[model samples]
Target: MTDTSRRSLLGALGALTVSAAVPPAAATASPARATPSTPAASPSPATAATSGPRSSMTFTGTPYDTAAFARSSLGELTATVLPGTPVRTEIRHGGQRVAVLTKGARTVLLPGPERTFTENKQSFTDVFDRLVPDPALPPAKRLKPGWGTSPSGGTWSVYGGTSGDTDFGVHTKGAATMLLKDTEAGRYATLTDDGISDADVNCVAAFDKVPTGNACSFALLFGYRGGGAHYRARLSFTTKGEVDLRVEKVMNGETTLLAEAGPLATEVRAGDAWRIRVRRKGAKTQVTAWPAAGAEPTRPTAEIEDSEAGLRSGRVGVRGFASPGCTNLPVTLITGRFEVTAANWETPPSVTHRDWVRLLDAPFDGEWTPAVEAIVRGWAGSMAPDVFSYAMMFLPGAPGVRGADPRVAGADVLGEAGYGKPDSQGLRPVGADFHDYLERPWTFPDQTRRPEDGQRGNLDCSGYVRMVYGFHLGVGMMAVKDPAKKALPRKSGAMVDFAPGVRVAQRTGSGGSAPDLGQLQPGDLVLFDVNDVAGDPEDPDAYDVDHVGIYLGLDRAGKRRFLSSRKSADGPTMADVSGASTLDGPGIYADSLHTVHRV
Candidate 1:
């Protein structure tokens, strides 16, 4: 978690008529009104765009597979890199080709497409085959399976493992290539014509499961059986003062640490020995430490602890090595490896169902709207969804002003250096904000005469709810800026699972680092209960339910106004937390619970 600021609604809040923004008689004058034909070049009527051949097909959980598409007219084909081996995703769709490998965010084309994929023609079994590696064979060897049979549609599934092999299981039913790689970070991921790099402390490798830090690790989680996860990592060495500690967790080669802490002690003295262990049980992760002398007191440090209880974990191997320092007693994760029995993955964290009545542990404070739920549910069902996780993963980090032309978010978003894309409904954070403004039908500079319009931006009420509902996943915030953004690309991930989407309750909080609750910051999502004095239900959304909100800090009057959108023409924004009872919505918004998600 790191520093973050809440996004303030940019445009002034006043409705405006669309007609007024259009040119009138004088502005719309024909070229005939122009003096002597000086090559009249008045703007001609813009033609309506013809719809491309898009079938009316739509998906909420899984995408619809177009008629077995082998031609370039359809789309791109991608692939995953094997551990130790540097792999890339190269697609030659319709000749408009592009190559993308693991570089965090921004995609790059290999020097030449033909040359780069010459060895991968065999990897081209089917579109989904791109998720794995294939070689030795050519495009002639193709495997076509029954199209409409799979419950999950055609999006290729991504995983991590071996390289340069054409033995990916394509036709063999139930056959899977065991994706094996060093779990901890600091293992090198570079590709040099030869073998893959090892995660020798100081070396960097991609991680399968980690909220932060570059050290790679894994766990076999028990959760939903849906989609997969995306991961990244970096390795670094830091220098401290007196005791130069060597520590390498995925490092970007930046940030000067007081001292670096390597996997093992920077120096092994005459009688010193190294012993360590790391494990993940659900949302909690434990790391124990010791020496050749045996279990030392005050040694085990809590790495990740979100819930109250501990959990059942796996084996923890020790990474051995150390490059001792001299005068200043240097420290660094000299070079080592973190071993694990398995990799546990969590699914979507934010997109979930909430019932306003049961959320008692946390305070139900956010403005819950059925319209928002409806929209989320709609989108979740439309895409191959577990729920909201995928939506949030695709959401923009910043919103744009109404009059501002939408642009490709284009790495403008923090942490999402390579993967952010843009579209109308849900694209860039700024675009979403601007669209929200339009839902308000907020005023435009040129249009002064007409106001109080019901546009997406100029909201009277309901439109705001609709737009917000659609793009809540698209809202950019402090969470998106954190290094963890790359670790967990699915915005809808749960504390443990992230297949379809995340559980709504876990999607709040801010920064790349944690924060104190008393000092509430902006862009924090507060989930709470809405109830009467008797603990009975109270209609927070007027539809009899619980709710949540994008916390705007403690309001000026000390009262908080949660920013939210619901299906209403005119709704109360600055509602009193004391009065609004969280009766229904996502059940997580209870009376006792008041956890804030900082994103």
Candidate 2:
């Protein structure tokens, strides 16, 4: 993509707050023509004051001053707007120009190109008011409680229990601590603070006597939105030194277990401190525990992603619950640290192979016809620019060869081949290595060779289509009753021959070729015979289907466009038939457009 196009896409990340007073023609009509213009005069000090905020000023003159207007507009929005840097407050795309400004978590866009500038009655305050941060609220800073201090002057709120004499106070000895103990059976006590939405609470806890026969537990509570709804990460200790870590959600007097870990074997002595940590953010929750003196475990004891029951923001705290038999048992919890912060939004350098596979399996949930939907899902799932690898095709060697190991081919021909890594917008450049890999012919090993001997990481045009459609729709391009008894095929011709749901829609070049381009929809398979060595066009047996692509509907210009992994500068790209070249030459449109298949 061009730099202008990329900038346009990036600007879309911020919410678009188009001025309501903008002229209908400017807002909805086609692109306006760019006319030559004279420089605009700078406004005087008195005139600038009456123009409301300088950021909301609109240049309204016949001969528009593009340069001066950009400077004045950018100056009001940001203090760091440099003249020549790429990070300049102003961005231009084709004939249109926009000024981008950011303050704290809010971003604002001001449209320009003085000649076509409309009266923007919208104020800067109005735009900022609509800006919503990702988490909606900022995270609280890490907190340390004062030792031997009461909950009255501190951040915590201590509540006395109604069931029995509950001791809810701080015990300051070696460290400042918050302790909660209940003597009554079937009663609970809590020490809470509403300072955080998403956070991690680390503390050490000990039971004076482990509960026997009845339940006794200490828990970290989050998403406490009152009305009996909250999420809990609990540690249940038994007299036998068994500890069970669990995550639960309590809503409307009902408790749902989200996740659980083992009744871990450990020595439980009186006052033996067990370090516990609970981290909750977004839809994910995790809990971990270990001996206070030992090193913390790398993995969490219990973790869950409960989008349905997960809470976004609420009061976070600690609580203790007791059953009938555990009346007199005292559970002590001492705080070490409470840290609440926003989740990282940056993308990692690379994702795992398993994660890459999950991207390929993303479901297609569009509101189109089933056939179209299948194809749309297939296409959407297969486009992963960050994870780059050469296309490889399955090669079944020899006919009627039972138990023959299938091999793959394509990567060897293109040296230094690997998956392409994309930028922030999931777009990767078509480098020299990718172009070299695509220029080779499809090849496969003979029946005697194993799959390991063939190219390791590669996929071709047909192979890509097959992998997506087969995995999602259960429709295979290369159908076989028993693969062990026969060799695998690699050519697009072979795929079309065995594709179960495919039917020929049109055939070009010879006998009768008339394709209704308007009838085409996204996901339709477009096949081509790149080599026209045979004379007969109508005869399917005469030509081999050397290339194939999936129709992706029309472009903004109403031209029919198809996506294909081609031997071009842009590895996998969307090409319009109106501007697409033929196999052997630079001619617009394909020379031997053999068949269009509805699959």
Candidate 3:
């Protein structure tokens, strides 16, 4: 644990934007080259840089900028599921379509429209098959189709594959606990971070969910050599950039909230803990801090502070052990489980087309919406096919759901966005390695904007921030027009220049590398300037403000998550940015955290 100071945090709150420049390669490919801080290479997805299908998805009605792409293959699994219902999902990829209907897992066959119930062929149910048909091979070679069969004309067993980010064809729950192994990574994890090392690991916990927006959480307790060989237990979670909050401890349904390193708030004491009682009273979970536990002499008036994190989430989970920018000593997390309450968990109403659109698009600027919402919203939707599907890593239903907006109201937002699927290499958005991938062509966006903005163009440095938080209605006023745009004494009256609140913080940059160590906060905005104006993590330069990400809590493993606005890793987009893609990464020039604003 670490102790965070107050004054230092306050001084760190500045509202500056960075040059939106990226590396010559990053502008084209967003160069990201980082190594894990944990042992054996296992860390949080916050730091795992890779690419994914840039689907045309709106935020929780609220969320980035990237390129649009040709979504020729962006279909998803759909089921009119009931809460607490159990169902198996089967996906076929590469050249393979759907397997046989009611045969043994191994006795499956290809489907056809004119060819049903005969010739040992599989039964076809969906219409997509009749139109496009299977690739005459395995989808991704993930499953050992036809047993001992290789669609690529090989002798190895071919499993199905994904047109999305995760690959390798085979994914299943491990032994110790319900865990998913990437198969290629040679590591089985609860969070499925693809993190693995030969270091001495003791206990291992099971990752049930990856917080909001696909960022998973898991804990590890292991013994490693850091100064001296000792045993340390730490947690890990995904983060946007820095951090704002951390779940210190959860007991008897009560949780402790701590601002690990906030620019507006004080740092978290190595042993300091905030308590939260989980009793859903109305729209929020009632949480009160600093109560008289036993009998502490007199109740001092030092201001009992408390914070509330949505079960749905504002920025996924707060960054825990890993801050997306930290590379601390090694400490393994072993034997644990993750618990996540869905934000959009109750998704029944949105199950239908009309309800789904209204549930997300909020006050859309245009009539066009997206189809990816039906799938992505599952994380918080009223119904979860099964936590295991995501928590343990399983596939969605096969033959993928088929439907047409026919309304054209939002027909091919995904196709128009150019949301292409990833290769079988399990490509992440961050830099597992800079400038590379395993499949499909990827190009960064020229400009990024709000799909709901009703207008188009890129979001300037500060504008990026205003737009991101703008998703939250009452977050503040700076979300729309700059408060500084107003007259003198522009304090509370203007959302332009936020006075000094207790938590929200920001930073901006225009040149030179970011600041040196001695400075960094959990939820501080990271603005950078890579090529010209400024950018954030998406830039190759030290201070590029053209991008933005949220600060998530850490995990038991201590590997940080760095969420950001990418160039659709695979194509062009409307505003050049959209959706919240949580990848593995860290902050830049820890010192570059310039302007800190607390609101």
The candidate scoring highest on TM-score is 2
**lDDT on C-alpha atoms for all candidate structures:** 0.22, 0.38, 0.21
Candidate 3 lDDT (Cα, 0 to 1): 0.21
**Per-residue lDDT for 127-160 in model 1, tens only?**
1112111223354443221111111011212222
Candidate 2 backbone overlaps, count:
16
Question: Candidate 1, 581: how far from true, in Å?
Answer: 18
Model 2 Cα lDDT, one tens digit per residue, 177-260 = 333345442222232322233444455566666666565666767776552677777777765678778888888868899988
Q: Give one digit per residue, the lDDT tens place, for model 3 in 328-444.
A: 312121222111111111111110010110112221121112442332323222221111111000000001111122311211111111112223322212221000111111221
Q: How should the candidates be ordered by lDDT, best one leading?
A: 2, 1, 3
Please list the residue runs of candidate 2 whose C-alpha ends up more than 4 Å from where it truly belongs after superposition: 1-154, 163-166, 173-198, 212-215, 308-310, 341-599
Error of 2 at 209 (Å): 3.4
Least accurate stretch of 10 residues (summed lDDT) in model 1? 115-124
TM-score of each: 0.19, 0.32, 0.21
Query: Every model's Cα RMSD, please?
Result: 28.1, 28.2, 28.7
Instruction: Rank the candidate models, highest TM-score first.
Output: 2, 3, 1
